[model samples]
Target: MIKKDVLFNEFLIRNATPEDAVQMEYVQQQCYPTLDPTELLNRNHFINHIKVFPEGQIVLERDGVIVGSASTFRCNFPTQESTFLESSDNLWITNAHVPDGEWMYGIDMGILPEYRGLGLSKEMYTVRQEICKELGLKGQLIAGMTIGYGKMKEKMTIQEYCYALEIKKFTDPTVTPQKKAGFRWIKPLYNHINDPEAGFACVFMYYPVDDNYKLECKL
Candidate 1:
């Protein structure tokens, strides 16, 4: 038990441990079909993350089973620029973490099928945002997903679809919920993820850890 229960009915969310890799791997495989399972983190990776910044890694537990996980690391990346991140391959290289980077890069967030649609994802993002604020991080860098684009591609251009999403006319299953949690779609990127659901591209988004949320915190 990590002291903070994060009570949500029968669910509990807490910081992850290196020992959680097995459970996290299972949840990742079950929830994230678009990602290559082989690319998923192993024990060593989880251990490294736990050592690097355990505050940024969170897991949701229900009935003594891990149902969701979120991974993040301090990274050197342009928050306001459309830089093309090639793949997840080079990003997870060991010892490549920047402990004091200006930005906190969200690496992954997933929830088991049985645990979906219960506002758990929003809870995880809230945890991440809290961690960023604690570490004095500037902003969050997420390659947002346009999950509903694949089906809509047949009826509209990618440009039109993204515009619709941007203007609140429509919402995607994944990104829209995240947007509701305060992330903004800043730009689009190529090869950000292996998923085609995003039209082979993912939106680059930025979320600030605003001090305005705290009464005594200064901007």
Candidate 2:
């Protein structure tokens, strides 16, 4: 276990390198049992994202050990179905489409259980937002998870087993912590289109990286 003072006093936040991918993969696997950790850690994808947005891909280290990881990048409106799901068509209409601008997207954020609840997650978000501001980003967008979707389940026309496994519940304590850091829930977005069994509901959240948004930490 990490020491109390060490958890509160100081932590290292830096851009993740290819060397950190293995440990990051471990952290993701430990944190999200239901999700496929390998998908995020695939060497090619990890390298591609890092090469594309090195500053946006970050990791938290404590005593030289990788304990948490997050990746942020510019995301445009959903012109196509989510890569996480199959099927070519899109579903559900919402006025909350992504507008033209350099909108920041928080793609993944995870921390190991032993190091959780120590305010490190929020600190990581702060760092991400700072990076966005430095890059002249306008807003940050996220597709948050949701639960209690009985009607949505029927609309997708999927079975119970697939539904239970695929449909993510809203209010994930892991991601919701971002609200305190400066995000506001925006609208609902779909993960899987037309597949009720695998379809998942997501709440979009936005946080403007404007002058009015104060930073609690020095960048």
Q: What is the TM-score of each candidate against the true structure?
A: 0.83, 0.67
How many backbone collisions does model 1 have? 0
lDDT of 2 by residue, 1-219 (tens): 111223555778888888887887777667655543333344444455566667677888888898988765565534443533221111111122222337667666788888788888878777777777777776676654443343456644323322343344343453357666777654445553222222455555677878485433211
RMSD of 1: 4.6
List candidate 2 stretches off by more than 4 Å.
1-9, 36-40, 77-101, 147-172, 191-199, 211-219
Candidate 1 lDDT tens digits, 1-219: 232455445877888987888898788777767754555566666667777777777888988788988777777665233322333324353344577786677767888988678888888787777777778887677877667776876787766777998898978888888888788666666555566666656677777787353222211
Which prediction has the highest TM-score against the true structure?
A: 1
TM for candidate 1 is 0.83
Q: Each candidate: what lDDT?
A: 0.70, 0.57
lDDT, residue 133, candidate 1: 75
Q: Which candidate leads in lDDT?
A: 1
Q: Looking at model 2, which ten-residue stretch has the lowest summed lDDT?
A: 86-95
Q: What lDDT is reached at residue 42 by model 1?
A: 61
